[model samples]
Target: MAVWDFAMPSPLHLCRAFHNSWASWTASEARLRIATSASDTTPLPAEAIHAPPLPPPVDTVYCSTDAGFSGPDRSPTFGFYVRSMDGAFVAAASGPLACPYDPLLAEAMAIHEALSWLQEHNYHNVQILSDCAVLVASFRDAGSYRSYLGIVLDSCLRLINSFPACSVKFVRRGSNLVAHALAKHVSAVEARTVWRDSLPPFISPAMI
Candidate 1:
């Protein structure tokens, strides 16, 4: 009969095999985490996060008005531009006031002139925008007025009441660029100009 010998794997070899398996799994896990971290830290585009919200749609015509005053004692100029809800220009007017007035009075005069123009054109549903916050506040308050400004404010209130549907709102100067430009132009000119269906080339770029 022949003798047979049996041998088992050494403890050290078993431990080495286990260690290799564990190390491979740990490396794979680390790589996955690094990929995840890279994706998580990526930056987003500026416009995606910082863009301004668009204005809501409207059913009524909108007009932007502004006034330019050279000084408290100098003649003021008024400018206004009317457009449809979809941004189609309807009319524009700019002229120097017959008398010199303070800033507040000038703004009130501009608002009054714009409302009168709208009434003349039979525009009932109108939304007026101005960059003067005080004027808007006064309209909202319907409070008492004093001095020359008081008379102008009273006229503005009366004109506002005539409209079947009218709204006055405050907007930033940037959004009132067209009207501001028109006011500036009128301040430099001696005659009053009215554009019923078109805008001057200088003010066209500011529209819409």
Candidate 2:
């Protein structure tokens, strides 16, 4: 049987053991720091994101126009309404055409009437909206007219040029309900009628 003796380690062996232990502890600490940094930088879920804000509303008035034609012999009537930027009714006008009856001509005349009315009221900055797409397109393209209605278009262009700021736009029929209602209500009229700071009872419901 061989006898086993327990002995204390030499200083050199102790120093080597201490160095190895310190290196192992430092490596473990560095790994922990890296893991913590990666967790902190993780991306958030899609639902946690936020969207940018919308821009503010524009500062401008809106005027909508429409025309109603009953028959070839009957005169066509037009209606127009001006609203503030916030859509509060500013003024309204409706009347029968003094010119010969034609649907396209009636639409152009309607716009002319509205522009003339605004010009008379000293409204420089104005935006004209119509349910008639062709009329709006003609005005946008600044086309010259040669037909019987050429004079009427020229008059409308002159009125538009008088304004310091003016624009013509085409809108959906549903959006021009008030103007349509006014046109239909005044189809029997033989003269021009205007309402300022007040709306007619017939178009009151449609204003909503």
Best by TM-score: 1
Q: Rate the local accuracy (lDDT) of all candidates.
A: 0.82, 0.79
Q: lDDT at 5 for candidate 1?
A: 69
Which pairs of residues collide in model 1? Answer: none
Instruction: Name the best candidate (by lDDT).
Output: 1
- What would the TM-scores of all predictions be? 0.67, 0.66
The residue-by-residue lDDT of candidate 2 on 90-172, one tens digit each, is 99888887666677888888888889888888887788889888877776545567786777777888887897777788998
lDDT of 1 by residue, 94-154 (tens): 9887546577778888898899999988888889999999989987555576577778777
Q: Evaluate residue 148 in candidate 2 and report its C-alpha lDDT on the 0 to 100 scale.
A: 61
- lDDT, candidate 2, equals 0.79
* Model 1: lowest-lDDT 10 consecutive positions: 1-10
**Candidate 1 structure lDDT:** 0.82
For model 2 the TM-score comes to: 0.66
